[model samples]
Target: MAYTIDRHPGPDAPRLGAMVLHPIAESVPRARRWFQKFIAPYNPACSVDDCALMISELVTNAIVYGRSDDPWVVRVEWFREGASLRVEVHNPGFPASVRVRRPDANDAHGRGLLLVDSIADSWHSGPSPFGGTVVSFVMADAWPS
Candidate 1:
């Protein structure tokens, strides 16, 4: 229910780049570009578009709930192991444990993670020692050179 939000260093990256996206509305466009460029060289299946959407939804969550004064962070890193691409969207904190439910007719909010859940081939959320929760998604693809 109550989760802390903080930035803690994560696993060693073996890919293009890892960025810390500030939890600000103005930062979304720049954040999407970061993901596009990262997958430009490899061009994996359903990768570029999917990754962008993933970033948008995850970062949007950080911006929405991280509270303007709370200083939220979106830590994103990509790595390929065997036959999968692992994309982790690290949030400073996790809200109360709530299942992803379809919104009612008048609902406009609460669909961010819903998008993440539907689009991402696989995803999960867990506690972060850094003080929050990191929601991760993985798309299966061959290793790139």
Candidate 2:
């Protein structure tokens, strides 16, 4: 079994795997729309939807926390690693050690990663060798939610 990982993908980079990059902003729903369009042609059923939400949460954090007008980058990269699908989002955020903390019970936010951590079969956030932090999640579908 071999695992293939591609960087900067398109028709020129090969089509076996799909990738999409968008400029991130404060509007999470808008960002998610790009994810939806990017995955729509390739993914059927609800897998893409779930993947979009995962992307939304990551991009939302990037836009809200990055606080930079240097044209933030939002990339959704995925490929099959054995039987599981791995998804990663890259942005120009400082690759510092970050911990998603739970706020007060009534807080309206700060729960996005919780949802992601809960839903993803295996998930983590770490520094990308290229730049910034990358939030990567792997879904096996067989893993208990």
Candidate number of the best TM-score? 1
List candidate 1 segments past 4 Å from native. 1-15, 67-72, 95-98, 142-145
Per-residue lDDT of model 2, residues 73-100, tens digit only:
5555665554566777666677674557
RMSD in Å for candidate 2, one decimal?
6.8
lDDT of 1 by residue, 1-145 (tens): 1122233244453454567776678667777787787567766766578778878877776666553346556666666655677776666666455246689879977787788888777888786555577777777763543
| Candidate 1 whole-model C-alpha lDDT, 0 to 1 | 0.66
Would you estimate the TM-scores of all the predictions?
0.77, 0.69
Candidate 2 similarity to native, TM-score = 0.69
- lDDT for each of the candidates? 0.66, 0.62
Off by over 4 Å in 2: 1-27, 40-46, 67-70, 142-145
